[model samples]
Target chain A: MSYKAKFRVWRGEGGEGKLEDFTVEVNEGEVVLDIIHRLQATQAPDLAVRWNCKAGKCGSCSMEINGKPKLGCMTRMSTFSEDETITVTPMRTFPVIKDLVTDVSFNYQKAREIPSFTPPANVQPGEYRMQQIDVERSQEFRKCIECFMCNNVCHVIRDHEENKPEFAGPRFLMRIAELDMHPYDVADRKDAAQEEHGLGYCNITKCCTEVCPEHIKITDNALIPMKERVVDRKYDPLVWLGNKIFKRSSSKS
Target chain B: MTQTTADSPARRQRAQIKERTLRTDQWWRYPLVTFIIFTAFLVYSTWAIFDTSYFASPYIAPYASPCLATSCPEGARLFGLAPFGDWYTLPPGLLILALPAGFRFTCYYYRKAYYRGFWLSPPACAVNEPHGKYTGESRFPLILQNIHRYFFYAAIVIGLILAWDAVLALVEKPVGLGTLILVVNAVFINLYTLSCHSCRHITAGRLNHFSKHPVRYRAWGFVSKLNAKHQQLALISMFTVVGADLYVRLVAKGIVNFPFA
Candidate 1:
């Protein structure tokens, strides 16, 4: 007997939505995403789900499968019990635009607020010199795919809507931190980070880090150092004095 | 060195070499190096608290009346509403700040690094005197270090308050140079704070599968760089705070001017 799988896919627009069930034939080597596409082609035309690169690389297939945020393309149908109902829904955190599509424009807006790279005055474009060791430190943060899975799972924004305006969320902050730690980038956004981006609101529960599919050390490498730097600037007496002396000396010279 | 005949000379030589190795390894067990590093941190932290005036200085140039209690501008205030009042009042505040940094320096991650990279072992355990082994309680105090999450939160809050103070100085007079320095200091603080290991772990926890995206790979690259010399920055970050604090204080005290006294 050929195997059949049941899929309850969310279908509708905006706030109005309902799950429509469709049973699709499955082969041994097929992934869940493939099955969804097959259903879209044969069972439900205009199914209205977003996907790019059947491979997981584009981060376009992010959705909740059976109550878990996952890349649809990566989840294998074989993992589920043959008779179990596979429920597919759009990510819950963001506002749904249409069907599985969500409005992730907020994340992009947060990205713009972060301080961009500013090389030191002495560093020319071509002649910029950074040790292999120094560049290696910032390399990990550059890997972020902007999937916002970390953002989605983050309780700061997910559970608390009030935090949305103030908080930059974990992924964006990690991006800012990545640029900040870059050996050649001289621009600093620490003040903006605190007031505008809401760096202080994160209680460091590590929920964002735990959900990062990239396995990036979001809490340890990005958030903690940013916090430490903030503390150092806020409280360290010597730095305060040095800034005073330097400011004085520079004015005279 | 004379070899005893109770065993072969080669065995005796091997024993002697092993003893020498043990003695060399035992040197760090004396608690002296740890004490020295701790003292150095204390001295640096002390210097950071009192001698510098970054947090307490006025925004204007040639700040006169260095000793006056009310000399501080609104920008120099610590934690928004609280003022240190005088230069002498900062040491206790600094002591409170330094405690966590010092404790975190001896965290499990650092402990593992020290054991493997530096080959340093803990001192003799209190309960295991007969075995002459270090079998101290590892669960409680180490687990207690988890409070770093809370400390991280506090650091962000305090850092913002300081940044706000810096902004107040910038807004009050709009000294271009002072503003630039203040901005730079603020940026460094945010960078250090955001790059914390705890934050990374928390963020990474949400990700279910990461094999598809190339950007995630790049993020790991950035994280690895910060993780490599985290210990060094852990120390430098503490010093940078002191440096920022001193800048604020000296300007507030009228011991120095914005441009120069």
Candidate 2:
């Protein structure tokens, strides 16, 4: 006899939700995503779960499977025991719009707070003279497919719901860090990062680092360094003195 | 054709040979080479730390002293050896090296690649085997190295302090020492940031299996090599900065003589 696996999928829209169970025949080469699609076709034709490309690259099928933020398509059903029942739910960080879809517009808003790049004054269009090494640093940030898995897993907004309004979360901070590290970006956004974006709230527990699908060093490379820069302007005695001296010199001139 | 070969030892031996040959390559394909390079860096750092020192007092060279015309009390105090001078020199120097090393290890790229054993022993083909129950035991200390996030905050704070000290050295007109420390801090920051596992992971042109562009694959191949060995240099550069900082501090504290100072 072939093994059969049971899935408890979240069913309903908006505030209405219930776990509906469906038993499906398990195959050797099947992943969790294939089972979900199979259940949708055979049992629940009206199911409205979101997915794209059916590959890990699309970052669309992000949901909590077995209470963990992961791409449904990438998770293999074989990782579980035959007797175990798999529970799937929408990501908790955002408001659920349907059975397995959540609103992620908050991330887009936070992204806008960061100042866009401004090129240097003496620039000609043909080609900018940048060393290969200089451009190499920010290139890592461009890989983000906006999965928001890092945002979902973040404890600041995930566990403490109050932090949502103030906290910019890990994904956008990575964007800010990416822009800050850009060699061509002349504008300094560190002050805005502190005053407006609430970068200081991130205590560097690195929970976001653990769940990142792209494996971005959110706490280490981006957030921590940006915090350090803010602290320098705010607290460093020498910078304070330099600012004061510069102010006086400029006023006299 | 092979009906009579079922019980033959020669056929069995051939089967065994094929199985053994088919076994996946070891994670560290060139362990000896990696070991030698790491060992050389370790030895050099140890030597650099113990060899340098200077007196606690500060004095300005005649050429570019800021106190020449005005009553630069701040400049005078900095010019002559003081507690701030000692405080300024050693701790920040060691920090310069230690922070970058710590950050690199905890980098995001390293975490993912190391978890899957990608860097040391990437499969010859990009295809993954069918998922099964994960049977491996967790490797603890290596896994726990993700604490680099905490270290990054510490490194950044320390780097800023070191940069301030560099600024002080410049204002006091000690051009040589100022340049040395500044250059050391900059290099440490560069190496630390560059060798970042997270940085490497994100910069991957496109994944080999997913990329549609032919040029992206070639670029990814180049970047992947740098990503593979990034963790090693990340450690080396971090320790190098720390050793350099310690040497400067020992000299500033009068515990050793700075041949350059």
- The deviation in Å at residue B107 for candidate 1 is 9.5
Model 2 segments more than 4 A misplaced: A239-253, B1-261
What ranges in model 1 sit over 4 Å off? A235-253, B1-261
lDDT by residue for model 2 (A49-74), tens: 78888778888988877666778888
What are the clash counts of all predictions, listed in order?
Answer: 120, 14
For residues B52-147, write the lDDT of model 2, one tens digit per residue: 332122432111122212222343333342333333443222323455446644564334333333332221111122232221111244424434
Alpha-carbon deviation at B87 in model 1, angstroms: 33
Angstrom error at residue A137, model 2: 1.7
TM-scores for all candidates?
A: 0.50, 0.50
How far residue B102's Cα lies from its native spot in candidate 2, in Å, is 17
- For model 1, the chain A TM-score is 0.89
DockQ of candidate 1 (2 decimals): 0.02
